[model samples]
Target chain A: MSDLKNLRGKAACVGAATTGCGEAPGRNSTELMAEAVIHALADANIPLHEVDGVFAATAVHSMAAMSLAEYLGVHPKYSSGSNIGGSSFLAHALDAAMALEAGLIDVAVIAYGSNQRTAGGFKSISEPMPFEAQYEPRNPITAYALATSRYMHDFGATRDQIAEVAVAARAWAGLNPEAFTRDPLTVEEVLAARMISDPLGKLDCCLVTDGAAAVVMTRAERAKDGPQKPVYLLGAAMAHDHRMISEMPDLTATSAADGGPRAFAMAGYGPNDMDTVQLYDAFTINTILFLEDLGFCAKGEGKDFVGGGRIAPGGALPVNTNGGGLSCVHPGMYGLFVMIEAIRQARGTCGDRQVDGAKLCLAHGNGGVLSSQVTTIWGTEETL
Target chain B: MSGYFDGPGPEAEFRQFLADGKFMIQRSKGSGIHVFHPRVMVPCSGETDLEWVEASGEGTVYAATCTRRRPEKGGDYNVSLIDLAEGPRMMARVVGIEPDQVMVGMKVRARIDDLNGAPAILFEPA
Candidate 1:
């Protein structure tokens, strides 16, 4: 019911943290989250006690707003503890911005933390619904495998073509000092990595790291008095199809196919206007599928679009500039990283990793086997 | 008389009082017709007049995936989305085929199997 045009806020993303990539740290989820929140507040030059709202997103652990507020030693006027999947963090930013515009809260802190890599922590605790119980557990890798199979069947795409996406990501990671796996990987290395699922190798899947990230958002007017630059929330959209992989109408096309255009239209920009992209990369297939679904390329042509150095650093569209969830730190909080990188690029604070002359960036998040999608367009200017 | 009814809780329960081998699908206690899973629900005009039908267990693979990485709780297995000839798609395990052998539109038949001592349906190449 909220109109995109009515949305107005001067929001500055302050502070961000990741545990890098690989094994889960010994630290608990709450500790990691609190650390990120404190760091973000310091980065924005704001006292931690001044934060008025808190929003948290997590899949592997639960931490309510009150508990987090207690941990951070800040009593927030407004709070949220919703879990909409990886993209939930970005959704939280939009929600915070709306709330700020409506005078609900002046400052909001959105954070995500998880320990998925720790032993005995990566499995679902609850049983599947009765309908879902009938089927085998289709993990993310398998969900992507089904879509990859269809992609190959329909487009005549080959393993080599898909491997190019990994190759490009690793190439970018080589340039990112904060990236988890910096070693340059070739198409063969990617193809030969331990096969997690048929047609999907170890390199094709994202790493599960233990980490947390936080962003302090406040009204543009408030942020203007704080940070030197404010990255405005130009547009945002969310969409869903079916929860279970089996019930999805089509595996290749995402709800983003609908959500992307709507967000872009709201922002008054197109794919070409984006200087950088932070797409959710749960797997190589998902990246390819989203490229098509987001209108970056034609349907069934994602493999071809990614084959060249297009997504590389100097290519047409520099994607996952922070190495993404694949090569960067994936805390099961993948969406947070996307937002972090987009803010960095839009603020032009990425230093050596900054996309030259960047102005517009797209941050995308995927939840539940690509079941839910949230697309956000951010800019250096205040559009509303 | 055997009948399916709502449980004391907010969930639906299937009460097998008769051995008619007939399964009636419905959206709610008071909807139009009875469909299957993923249909949201089948509307039935009245609960008493619900139509009962037999399942063929014959279907085709609408989509499938080979999973080498499954949650620790769920044993590793290949998963698939199957489309029945009667007009509904369901999730099941693909058996009797190599991971590379599974393809879309492949003919398959459902086989009810024991999953940790409970009844669960799986599929194999027909």
Candidate 2:
């Protein structure tokens, strides 16, 4: 398994693309997937015929791997769908890296697209396994609220502190032209927003939008020859601690405890080494938890860590520069968007939201009500 | 391996006990540890023959949350993680308090409530 860590620098994410975001009423999931793939291939300047490997988050439409393979008409070797929720795509990226290392396939495409808002909004994960169906926590919102409540009770964090996350998210979103809701949101506005769950207000949750995003990963050598300056994959790791929220070892922690160290250690850096970070923001609670567990700060100091202008643009650490799922497009699972933003940042292509001369960036994904975590460290080729 | 094994097994027996207004958790015959969500085997020791023990129905709230997504069924509902005295934990709702009022480490006792046409376990402040 340690030898697999040597797969480090062998592959790089060469292209990233997002399309059909916001309220696109006409396009369905399939069309959005195809459009994103076309744009991503165009970004890479690689023909559709060169692709062999594919991984997709098929939560929007079930067996989207085979369906996407058939749609694109480029079937070669490998295909997989391990939908562990939003982090599914990063798991796909991690698995695709392993597959590419094993000499199984080349040019992997991890894609996701959904019409959540146009379709009247997302349907929470309802599928249960065995005893889960018989005995279950009926709502995902309630589950997340329980986590926030526990975080507050345990760490003495306050609602306003958590609301600071939303305020920062909108600040970044203000710079993004394509973000769904870019209106400046004050901490007061976030606190004043209607409460959906006990602690999480409407703003604390992500935007429901129609969107598609895809990433193309190929050999680092080939990436050098590609059109876009390749963003080398420095390190990547994925892990899930619990399937059920009740079964999580600790309420305030997540798989980031295990995944963060593995990803950063392989890349030979620490949280302090990251130029900017893009931790998943399915809820504001997630940002705080990820910041703490990923070693940005000590366990319970996340509220203070993000209290000042720390995570906002032009701050010491700019996060979710594309505004993230909070103000950007959260078309169901958002792992793919995380990749797109990381790659663009590494390439220094983000015009306005770009972190000035960001040499290295960390893109993390959280899935299934914080069930799984996948972290990928992407850096400019200069670092490689 | 240990105490009484009723003919119905864990899952069926768990549902049956809910109808009887009783709460039970699986105790490993080998390790004598309690496991929750009704299963046939012990997690750590792989002890197959588990015994059912009636819980004191008394526990403490590990965490609690209020959700308001589904308005048609009901606007909001509170779900909580309750840590039982029997050295196990379970997920259910606590009654007799507003969802916002429930706090971590609050002592609660188990009670049965009708949900979706069947008796389901719930916790109330002790």
Candidate 3:
């Protein structure tokens, strides 16, 4: 939550795009980021010269905001590099909105790009080489697995329940032609898949591919001149709970618990008001925690909430409608794509997977093994 | 490494304790908070008055997972978080048992082992 409450300056996401998603071998991170920025500008029908604020994050790029600005040849008055983790994009989105609300900038570009699949598999050393590396907590996978193990021990959540998240994501992927893995998926198949880390099979983990996504944000009045109807930002919240998995205060809880309520209160909305949802799914364990902490279900009921086509197509709550990192395109950091998908759904631009006359959407991004959480709510003009 | 790492600055004494085959944690005199990772600051209260104390090294396995990267690669091992007796948790691998046998809440103790050609910490069922 920010000090700038009851923001009078209305902000809308006027444009968004994804580029070099999937296995794009030749496209480097720089090229992919540039492509996404250009595509996003075109989608907004705003010239590149109009962008006065820039925000960028990438696993492979340092000082990403400055690098992207140099590459795109666009100067900016406000710039920031929020490399919190996969959730950095959501953090950037919130930062952009806060800056816009404060009259710091008029137009902001939030961007991300990565070449994890094509350049190098997701086998690189930890960014700072997790301090506990010598003690051997196999990264993100095992670190997250520990939490899943504790969840089962505490709440009786089963492996099949966790696999259900993968099945739902894959089913949604089958609807989008741009999704990387669209083939049919099942619980048994997910359980049988190779185990990368205990309690998490290959299917339970997100895809490793080349991808980039970007969004253009401007005050609602400035967005009136854009190409498509603006998707207004109703509320946003970001929190950093911990950096290392061992330092997490509660094994099953994350910063999502802190950000979820604040964002909802900011918008005066609740879980039942959501027409659709898009949550970061770096690991199925993350979805379960978000499902519970985001108040989609009672605590410890996330395992049941996601099972038996609960989040799949035609379900009561359609989540990860554009496939998601699990089945769609998860380059390295995946938060930006959630914003892109949320914006698409808010604008009624999602082709076949669109929620029927959807008016409100919730997108949550988790970073650093559920350490950092950034939650944002979007709404069409009708809902506003 | 970047400048100004506020959490824990080069815990040289912690490493020295490790060299002597002893497990150590920081006990903040100001607040009596036991800090793992040899950090100087107390999490419960922002106090830097710390004293290094040898830990009991006995802990309960809060969580565990078997990490395997390939079918034919090196044998899988169990990574776990141990809730030490001092009320601090640590990241360490559980040894002397099959990777899948390390159960949560099981009793465990720390032992020094050579990892990546350097002395490091590991856990075994107590």
Task: DockQ for every model, please.
Answer: 0.57, 0.57, 0.69
Give Cα-based local distance difference scores for all models.
0.75, 0.83, 0.85
Chain A TM-score, candidate 3?
A: 0.97
Candidate 2 wrongly placed segments (more than 4 Å): A129-138, B1-9, B69-75
Instruction: TM-score chain B for all models.
Output: 0.62, 0.85, 0.85
DockQ of 3: 0.69
Residue range B4-94, candidate 1, lDDT tens digits? 4333211222213112322223333454333455223342233444333455778898776676644685544677778776666777777
- CAPRI tier for the interface of model 2: medium
Look at candidate 2 and tell me the lDDT of residue B66: 73
Q: Which segments of model 3 are wrong by more than 4 Å?
A: A1-4, A123-126, A129-131, B1-10, B69-73
Q: What is the TM-score of each candidate against the true structure?
A: 0.89, 0.95, 0.95
Count of backbone collisions within predicted model 3: 0
Model 1 chain A worst lDDT run, 10 consecutive residues? A118-127
- The fnat of each candidate, in order, is 0.77, 0.62, 0.84
> Which portions of model 1 miss their true places by more than 4 Å?
A8-10, A14-24, A118-129, A382-384, B1-34, B38-52, B69-76
lDDT of 3 by residue, A1-384 (tens): 544347422788998999888987877888888899899999988888888899987776768999999998888889998788888888887888889988999889999888879877874334544447775666777778889999999999999988999999999999998999999998899999998888888898889999888999998888778888888888888888688888898889887888888888877788899999899999898888998899999889999999979899999999999999999988878999987898898898888898888888999998877788998899888767
* lDDT score at residue A226, model 3, on the 0-100 scale: 81
**Per-residue CA lDDT of candidate 2, range A210-250, in tens?**
89988888877788998898888888888887778877778
